[model samples]
Target: MNIYFNCMKGIVYKELIRFIKQKSRFFSALVRPLLWLFIFSVGFKTALGLAITPPYETYITYETYIVPGLVGMVLLFNGMQSSLTMIFDREMGSMKILLSSYINRNYLLFCKMFATSIVSTIQAITFLLIAKWYGVDISFLAIVITIPVIIISSIILNAFALFLSSVIKQLENFATVMNFVIFPMFFLSSALYPLWKIKDSSILLFEISSYNPFTYIVEAIRFSLYLKFDIQVFLILGISLVITLIMAFVGFKSKKVNHG
Candidate 1:
């Protein structure tokens, strides 16, 4: 038990240290969401109706409404970024020693995923604080409550990316993955708008977004921020987590069997 805990701690610490050293990472993660909150959201604010319904209540500013989704964007992008780092490390020979340290690759993969999740959670909190400064306020308790949701979302995303890594052979080809996977997931999901709003725009877009796992993730985070329990969102997130875990496990196992 101690050994496993120690390994997890070491992995997390290493990731944190790497994160600290990469100042650009901190800035970029914060900047992307802040740009949305400050720039794009401002323009879109006028485009959206005055009434946003629940989560944001009947009346709220666009900045306030998009806060949760921006946080989700941070997690989503960071999750993919973590997987990119993994591919980079593997190609550069940095992961060679780590892979040999554990007999079961999944255990080590979990350490990486969990640690990346913690990092993403921290980024989410940082963004929240910045949002507060921008006049987007939520209760302190609500902030604390959303931590687990962020962690779970992060793990699911990173695990899914890890599964992708198992299939993708070349590290240099991540740009294609980003274009096809990350952006489409973000744009199609409820990250930028509500399902009802999307439904109003286009039924086909609404259907695609409705089935997106990230839509549920954003919904879960949004509900938590409002001090509400959304059973449907939780159920979706739980199932997605289980499915991604299985996919990652199978991906890693198959990869190992093939490599050996």
Candidate 2:
């Protein structure tokens, strides 16, 4: 029992130290979303007006509506980035050594996922604070309530990327996979614009966005920020976390069996 706890603690500390050393990585994570919040939102706010939406009582500016999406963006990208580290560790033989310990492989993977989720959650909170400073209107209470939602969303996303890492054998391949996964997931979802807008633009996109797991994650965060809970969103997120963790564990287990 204590061994498991200490192992998780060590993994979390190592990830934090690595994140701290990579100052550029942290900045880029914040910069990507901030650019969307500040620059892209400014240009689109006038061109595209948002109507009253769920978790929002009245019409909102594009900036306000996209805050949760940007938060999702932080989780999504950081999740993928953490998987990149996994691949790096694997290729460097560190992952093999880590798993060589008596610790269960699945638990180790979960620890890694949880550690990265913590980093992603921190980044999301920091982004929200900056958004508040920039006048996006997130209250302190909302931030507090949204913390657990952020953690859940982060875990799901990290599990997703971890599953992807098991299939990807090389760092180069992950870059391609990340592009294939990240952009389409971001653009197709209700992240930047609402689903109604997507429906107006293209029915195909609307249908796809409805099924995108990232959509539910974005919505979960959005509603949580308003102190709202949607059972449907929670259900979807719960299912996603379970599915991804199972797939990720199986994927990594196959590799271990084959290599051993």
Candidate 3:
């Protein structure tokens, strides 16, 4: 147990140090999400209208309604972006040292995931604070409730990144996968709008969004932000975490095989 804990501790420390050393990358990860919250949301506040949804008492501005989505978006992209960097480390041979270290590989990976998720969660909280300053209705209790959901969502996203890094042979190819997978997943989900709104435009989109894990994440945050609970979000997040961790394990095993 001590060995296992040490491994996890080392991995987490490595990830945190790496991120901290690269101040530019850390700031960039933070800036994009802030831009979405401050500039884009503010500009579109009037353009998008909101109908009454559960957890909301009356019609709200689009900016207010989409805060949870924005938080999810930050966690989602940062988690994936961290994975992309991991892939680069592998290709550049830096990850070899990590693999060869005394720590268990699985524990190391978990530590990495945990560290990245923590960072992503911190950014999400920052976004929430900014939203609050902008007059978004968030209570102290709601913010407290949202923390676990953000952590779980970050884990799911990081797991996806780890899986991708394991399978894809080249860094360039990772970008292709992101374009095909990530963007579509984000825009198609209820992140920007509610499910009912999507259904109004197209039933097919609504159905697809219903299945998207990101939809559940957004909904989970949306409900938590209102001091409510969403069972669907919990189920989707749980299943996604399981699947992602399985994939990450597979990737780690494959790497061990190739290296051995």
Leading candidate by TM-score? 2
For 1-260, candidate 2 gives per-residue lDDT tens digits of 99999999999999999889989888999999999998999899999978897899987889999999999999999999988888888888899889878789999999999999999998999999999999987899999999998998999999989889999976888779877999999999989999999999899989999999999999999999988888998899899989989988988988863235
As a whole number from 0 to 100, the lDDT of residue 29 in candidate 2 is 96
lDDT of 3 by residue, 164-239 (tens): 8888887889779879888988988988878888898899999999889888878888888988766766777788
Candidate 2 lDDT at 187 equals: 91
What is the C-alpha lDDT profile of model 1 across 52-76, one tens digit per residue? 6656656777788889899989998
Model 1 misplaced regions, further than 4 Å:
50-52, 257-260
2 against 3, candidate with superior lDDT? 2
lDDT of each: 0.87, 0.92, 0.81
* Candidate 2 whole-model C-alpha lDDT, 0 to 1: 0.92
TM-score of each: 0.94, 0.97, 0.91
lDDT of 2 at 59: 77
Ranking by lDDT: 2, 1, 3
Which rank order by TM-score, best down to worst?
Answer: 2, 1, 3
The candidate that achieves the highest lDDT relative to the unseen native structure: 2
